[model samples]
Target chain A: MIGNPQSVAPEPSFRDFSKLCVHTITTKPWSVEEAAEHFAMSGIGGITVWRDALANRNIYQIGQLLRDHNLSIVSLCRGGFFPNLEAAGRQAAIDDNRRAIDEAAELGAPHVVLVCGAVPGQPLTESRKQIRDGIAALMPHAEASGVRLAIEPLHPMYADNRSAINTLGQANDMAEELNSPFVGVAVDVYHLWWDPDLEKEIARCGKNGHLYAFHICDWKTPTLDLLNDRGLMGEGCINVRQIRSWVEAAGFNGFNEVEIFSNRYWAEDQAEFLEKIKHGYLYHS
Target chain B: MIGNPQSVAPEPSFRDFSKLCVHTITTKPWSVEEAAEHFAMSGIGGITVWRDALANRNIYQIGQLLRDHNLSIVSLCRGGFFPNLEAAGRQAAIDDNRRAIDEAAELGAPHVVLVCGAVPGQPLTESRKQIRDGIAALMPHAEASGVRLAIEPLHPMYADNRSAINTLGQANDMAEELNSPFVGVAVDVYHLWWDPDLEKEIARCGKNGHLYAFHICDWKTPTLDLLNDRGLMGEGCINVRQIRSWVEAAGFNGFNEVEIFSNRYWAEDQAEFLEKIKHGYLYHS
Candidate 1:
């Protein structure tokens, strides 16, 4: 159980898009309206909206538009970049997070994913402290909005500027320290696949009822760009099926969210890419 | 101490290149012969020769030439790519490793660093098992040659094709499991700097006498190329000096080997680059 979790659970079959969810950023070329139309047309179950996608649009109307298409608002793309050097900056981040929570509440989304930032030269230890303080400050606002906060630990390659919390273990520790029902963890396959302790940590967070969201994508072998160049599920080496089994075993009956950021795929017709995602979902994931 | 090891150790000042070593791959433009002469002229203390740099060279004579230049032959650059899909491929890798051990012994190097390879489609657990078996197979030969095998954990970005061992904890675990004096771990800042468990694992390996080598380099803020694009010391966000303090505090009295693979630096005058390495070694490292 400790070392070989994959062996204990047989591979689960995925027949349709009932549990499939696509992030707005995955098909970056599409407008939110277009994405909602296409996702609903393709029978995709849900959509995670990036903050940018909601720009210049009436958020309430946009939520209505998505619901009109029968799309469940999975979660807001991001809200955390909480670590900052100055008190003003930290306060600004808290304010922004509060707004994100408000937006999520209005959008009928359940949670806001936290990228939990790191400053370039700031010690990760200090950045982590700032992240904790920022999250604590936002808890009251989040509770009032009836929105949960999902702390998404980024890849270690992004540790310099993207996140101080680079492991699920760290995210779990922070969530437990805060001891809030409004705070939890997001499990992203692309970021956490390489970790040896992933299974144990997944179980740990799940058992504590802190597993809020699950995101899926593949790690391309020759990842050309650090921030982009993510592969579709079947294109890379990650055993997504095995990891999905771990998540399902942990009592996460949520969407198998497809969250990819790829310049190559974005340049193509997103409708075609959506078909590929479904194919990958059925056979590879 | 459990979380912030850097705050516990004071930064040590480096006055000279007496403990500085450079890997041959750092100056890829130079031949081993050219690297030896230039490194000696620059008063660099040691050189770790990459296997590619040894092409068609007389190993014994190369060792003699390095000694003549008053350069300590540090551990050979690499010897492991143990994980393979086929038994024949695995056997072939072991044979190559044995040959690498022979070359290291002939080159008067004390150890050979292992990259511990992974196949794109292989599960990391299976690859790790193959790595352990491959290393175990080489232990007797390594001991006979009075040469050690230092398992160098690569960055997790390389988990697809480069190396399955991506954390110092994993490397330390493998080395201890192999349970041979000829088996040990190499600490590289570029690969392990982002790990939260780094300090504890460094102390663990050092206490067990399994910490065999220490490599130094910086991770660029915007790492352009996955294979190359390494930064000079002080060029990126990694706390190279702080990590060095931890390595030293863990009772490692080995050379601070500068190992960079940057396409940008290789395009520069290597003699000038050597001067920068000396400066970075003194002030940044």
Candidate 2:
């Protein structure tokens, strides 16, 4: 009752690479092609492509390149910055999201992760409304393209300008209100590990059949940068394995996407970092 | 309903400094005597004494000095760091908290704010239990000394080691569970502003008569340092005045305590910083 607040399932054994996925941004030093080659060589199971990694590239060709390496295409990294002061700006964000969905569909990716947006000076309530409206506007495009939208709740630290959806409960509220098979929530450990309502909310989302994607990372104690500075699994305090157990118990049988944005790790030899990720995935996660 | 999720009260006019309180640590460069002289000269209404500011000084004399300046001695800055992995360490924390309470009594402050502690890797649930038990253990002495304890829920960013209590609702639950007249919750906008449930929780704590203190500060956008990069009111996106309105509506007519820990502000001239604080207090807050 004190520590294990609920019946948290024990960690699943990682005997193979079937469930391991890596975000392209996690290996910043490597180009998409390089990441694909290295990831395939490392026996990485999947790859979540960031938009930046696909710049100036042919979406279909890149998709083929990844598939040729036997890397499963997970969700696209992001597509949401919906809150804007001006009407035109909001429209621009929505239009950009449509493009992201189109790209994901072309790339053979099943879903696009949405980092629901916030404006710094705008009231969070207004921002929340805008995020909901933005997502609703995209539902048609998403469904038509056969691409799902996963609402990824950011940490409270990012509530200012990153995302008004700072809790899984808030994300669930929005997703349920929207009510689309094409709309669901992404569970990211880095953003949600500290939430006290995590287990209960995970169960709620799972029961509602809204859990779509699961992202994994750790939170360093003296997190040097708000944007970067995430720890690799087993390098920080987050019980990634425990959270994974909860995610699995919630009926999410998805890739454990290692979506780190650490300047420290990115500065390292990326191949070595990939090796560490494998070790962490096998042992820590 | 989109922007103002509930009926948030409008900002109260800051016609005077009668309700303004400044924490000593806010002016980190100043000695307690220096802070007292400057604060009184500026017509600041109250002072919350941080423990470090009273080091190796006569507590009774400092109390007399503060009173001599016609300043209201607000609650002492802190007391609790209750959670510890070792029994002896936990006892040491309790003993230190007792000393903090005694210091508050000597300084003529009403309550000692509790920054309930956490071990870096300790499960927050376990740390939470330790925090509850620790506070419950200190109830007798707290009652005997006629000193109150305010459980200050820190930001989730500090959930790693600073404090396990990261939400005002959690603090309210603990205060209600403890069922002590000597124990209550401190609502700090810097910590609780991002919470979607804040307005409801504030109202809940107020209805239960568990609201003890209110601290004010801004949360910067690019929060460079987790501990020392807090923004001054109006300099960031927090909408401090609006939050102040909510607290006032919740029946909290306590001092609007300015508790900023900013490396940017601290590096400036302390006197000029005090002027800025006054300006921020009147116009922004």
lDDT by residue for model 1 over B1-285, one digit each (tens)?
A: 243532333244435676899999999899999999999988788999999998998999999999999999998979889998999999999999999999999999999999999999799999999999999999999999999999999988899999999999999998889899999999999999888899999999999999999999888887888889999888888898888989999999999999999989999999999988887787677
Candidate 2 docks with a DockQ of 0.67
Please give the RMSD to the true structure for each candidate, in Å.
4.2, 4.0
Off by over 4 Å in 2: A1-14, B1-15
Give the C-alpha miss distance for residue B141 in model 1, angstroms: 0.2
Interface CA RMSD of each prediction in angstroms: 1.0, 0.9
Task: Report lDDT (Cα) of residue A127, candidate 2.
Answer: 94
How big is the positional error of residue B191 in model 1, measured in Å on the Cα after superposition?
0.8
Q: What is candidate 2's TM-score for chain B alone?
A: 0.94
Name the TM-score of chain A in model 1.
Answer: 0.95
lDDT per residue as tens, model 2, A65-95: 9999999999897899999999999999999
TM per candidate: 0.95, 0.95
**Candidate number of the best DockQ:** 2
Give the per-residue lDDT digits (tens) of candidate 2, residues B145-251. Answer: 99999999998988998999999989999999999999999999999999988999999888888898999989888788888999888788898888888888999
**Model 2: colliding residue pairs:** none
Report fnat for all candidates as fractions from 0 to 1. 0.48, 0.54
